[model samples]
Target: MISVFPEVSSQYLIGGEWKTSSKIKEVRNPAKITEFVGEVALCSETDVTQAVDAAENAFKAWSRTSVDERAKRMKEAAEKLSTVIEEHVSLFVRENGKTMVEAKKDLLRCVEVMSKGADTLLEWWKPVHVEGQAQKVQIRKRPRGVTAVISPWNSPMILTFKRAIPAILAGNTVVIKPATYCPLTVMSCLKIIESSFPPGVINIVTGSGSVVGEALCGDTRVRTIAFTGSTETGKKIMSLSSNSVKKLYMELGGNDPALILPDADLNEAAIKRIRLGILRASGQVCSAIKRVYVHESRYEEFVDKLKKEFERVVVGSGIQPDTTMGPLNNRSQFNFVKELLERSKQIGAQVESIGQKLDSASWEEGYFMLPSIVTNLSHDSELVRAEQFGPIIPVIPFADLDEAIEMANDTEFGLRASVWTSNETAAIDIADRLEAGAVFHNNHTVFQNLRLDFPGIKESGLSQETRWGGLELFTDCYGFAD
Candidate 1:
């Protein structure tokens, strides 16, 4: 049983102040849809203007601050945030439907990313000197003024902080718009972070994408748009920002693939890690494994192991101590995943629900779903092709390595892929051939290093996030000579 938590009322942060509006939108817990979580201000276009105005006014002074000073401020902010990261864990779970463990990790990652940004700031901004016979030229980086950071619902705080912090540390003032579905926790975290910055340096607005998104992208004062969402929304941002030719850094949707070669070992330990990669956060991660390609010789063995692993998943409220998996974040996503499973079955795919419900009596009341293992799916099947963004995954068999490679690269997205094999050399070869932003050997789902540059090709994304190359996208290069 879950205890009732106090309802949270969120307000817009503009010019270093919390501002409220007449228009209000209610937020409900996906784990218990009838339970009210809180309300947020449904900001209009006027609110967008005020936030951008504040950001634009502050950019001049912010951009002129010494790099060392900017880094110091960000470092201090990270230190201050670390002390209170644990306080917001429950609020995050109720608002986002992520397990308590995941929520804690997410908040801690926010602190880690901010600290890394401060540590790397000085080295990242050193001017490059170009010498010629005539004159010496120095190339320096300048911040793009008034960056609009639009973050997604899943892992909102970390994603927003990763982009917004770097943009601010780079000397850019920002106007942020957190996802409408789950904004309370993000808003709460931002309020703590806002105290570290000066007035107008960090501003936030909450509203529908149609009203607020249009305002920010269409505004001439917003010089850069840092967005993370669906590919369709990414396209709309590009079209809207084209008038001003704003610099765009987007990390969109992905249908990541995982390939298991015949020579690979399928032990319980390996299967557990694979299960976590597929079902973590109820498979809400954009880079999660949506499709699996197993060698024909190992298909039956792989399927049996995966199915057994799924059986251990416990579906219930995120607050439950024994719950391994939680509900979908919202009603629309729940409907989409349910419908996708039904349609896949209708088309002759074998979709089997393989998991336990913590409370069968109250199962239908919430947005809870069992982890499903799908088989008998063709390369072009809807379940195999689409980004389900749920715990359901399609495991397709391939006759040979060539067939596996061909099938994996057939998707419209290329965010991540992995190869499993006993031979390290063979794994590397297959990883090199796969079409994805990042590839792993023997394991999938985790990013080992954040400093490396990993930009997805095709529609997966533009630029990257939270490190050496990713931070560079928030600025512009200027060459100087005397």
Candidate 2:
């Protein structure tokens, strides 16, 4: 079947040029299973070395450039990105399996992060002047040389730019290894950047993570490794990176919780946030609201309201204008979600279908699944404790604020949380006590501020993004005393 969107060129960008090889991987549209969108070259170990060498050579000159110069280059790249918004968004929808609306938003977020680097870096770059006895001390920020960034398949473009933009603004050369499944979007973004920056400043390679990722992290010249993916893989990268003691920034998995208090506005606050949590990006977000702890007094009402609202979501191909949710990125993801739903059923969780299934005629071949809500599950159930990266949410009942807070903090992953309550003081009080790195009071946990720092506390990974603090992740701190 011919795809609604035409097949576009898909190739790797290394040292300011597009590359193709005899070995290419076909990229399929998740919404149209038979459609082949394009093909990407599978980088071998030699390609990985070449990309790394380009970045290494670029760092010598690029890292020495004034911060102002680097900022100018980044701002230009951001403006160039704006011109390709439609094209970039189209690629995101086709390659990453996100709805067109969501893709646009993600592209805009990437621009926001890149364009605001000047202001973001200024705060961290401020010279620390210390008046000491008989001498003066001033501390300055320095680049960490070449940085290797390995991004995941979900939200590929946004996460890739998140790490790359900051690293570049801090005057560090970056070598990107994007997930093979969604390298097209990142390659498109990199093409725009390559046109603006000098050769070797920014390079991209496409290949399996195990082969390409290990070589990049294990390279002695690569000074830092910023990764975003599964916790198990993150641990392996950490072990491999120990040889060089490369500076590391890991953003792993998350199992966020949303607590609904008895006094909360179920209609406005609770329902709206819950819908965003599980429904946004088809529930593929790391900080997605996977579990909900509702006050027993309002449990039934919350569940009913959520079901009605979830039913209103429209699922279709990401390129369609009316699509609010898209198919899972691939078959593995679809099966993983299906397995989780089945497990919930076996555990005696009350399973309820909330959204309409995709049209059997057009979408039958795609990796699609229905939106689901499970209730009456104990807090200790795996459904409640584990991260469900799908359109499934489990609702657990709590008797009081103490119990709600306890349940919210019970997980080993402390990435994000949300609390909904009518009382402003009570909401803020509870927000302060939540164990997660970020807490949303009377709102959902999906909101991310580009100027504010965003990261997790525990297993959710190390480091943050959006602010000057993130810029420091690509820099090395040095001390000098005389």
Reference-based TM-score, model 2: 0.94
Judge candidate 1 against the unseen true structure and give its global Cα lDDT, from 0 to 1. Answer: 0.86
Candidate 2 total steric clashes: 0
TM-scores, all candidates, are 0.96, 0.94
- Measured by lDDT, the strongest candidate is 1
Q: Could you report the Cα RMSD, in angstroms, for every candidate shown?
A: 2.1, 2.4
lDDT of 1 by residue, 1-482 (tens): 11244323658988988887778887788889887888777999999999999999988898999999999988888888888877788888888899999999889888887888877888889999987638878999999899999999987987788789889989999999998888888877777777888899999999999999999999998999989889999999999998887888888888989999998889998888789889989999888889899999999999999999999999999989889999999999999999999999998889889999999998887899999999987889888889999999899998988988988999878888888888999888888888899887777766755555454778988986545735688889999887
Worst lDDT 10-window in candidate 2: 1-10
Give the local distance difference test score of model 2. Answer: 0.80
